[model samples]
Target: MKQLPPEYYALLEELQAVDFVLVELTLYLDTHPHDYDAIQQYNQFAQQRGLLKKQIESKFGPLQQYGNSYSGYPWNWDDAPWPWQV
Candidate 1:
C-alpha cells in the first residue's frame, strides 16, 4: 500500500464511526418505526456519511470496489488483497 496522510486514517475512522451509528439507527428504526426523532437523526447522519465518503474519495481513492465506486486510474481500486482480507 502507498503512504497515506494521517488525515486519511482519521477520516476513515470517522466514516466508520458514522457508519456504525447508521447501522444502529437502522436497527432501532426497524423496531421503533414511529420515532420521528430517530428517523430525522438517521437521515441527517446518512447525509453526513455521504459527504464524508465523497471527501475521502476525492482526496484519496474509492472506499470500495465493484460498481460502488468510480476511478480515473486503473489502480485506484487496489489490485492487491484488501487490508481486511487475510
Candidate 2:
C-alpha cells in the first residue's frame, strides 16, 4: 500500500478510536439506559468525531460522495485518492 501523510493517518486513527468508543457506549447504554456518565461520554466522543470529520474533510476532501462534506471547485471527489489506496 502507498504511504499516506502522517497527519492523515493520525487523524484517521483518532477518528476510528472515537467511533469505537461511541459504538461501545451505545451498546452499553442499550442495557444500562440510566447511566448518565456513559451517556455524557458518548455525547462527548460523538462531538469529537464530528469535529475531526470536518477537519478531515477540509484537509482531504469529502469522506463520502453524496453527503454535505463536499467543498471546493470542479467537483474533485472523483479525482482524489481513495482512503484504501493511500
Per-model lDDT: 0.81, 0.82
Model 2, 3-80: lDDT tens digits are 458999799888889989999999999999999999999999999999998998788777766665775687766754
Q: Which parts of model 2 are misplaced by more than 4 Å? A: 1-3, 84-86
Query: Which candidate number has the best lDDT?
Result: 2
* Model 1: per-residue Cα lDDT at residue 40: 100
lDDT of 1 at 78: 56
| Clash pairs (backbone) in predicted model 2 | none
Q: For all candidates, what are the clash counts?
A: 0, 0
Q: Model 1, 31-66: lDDT tens per residue?
A: 999999999999999999999989988887776777
List TM-scores for all candidates, in order. Answer: 0.86, 0.83
Model 1 misplacement above 4 A: 79-86
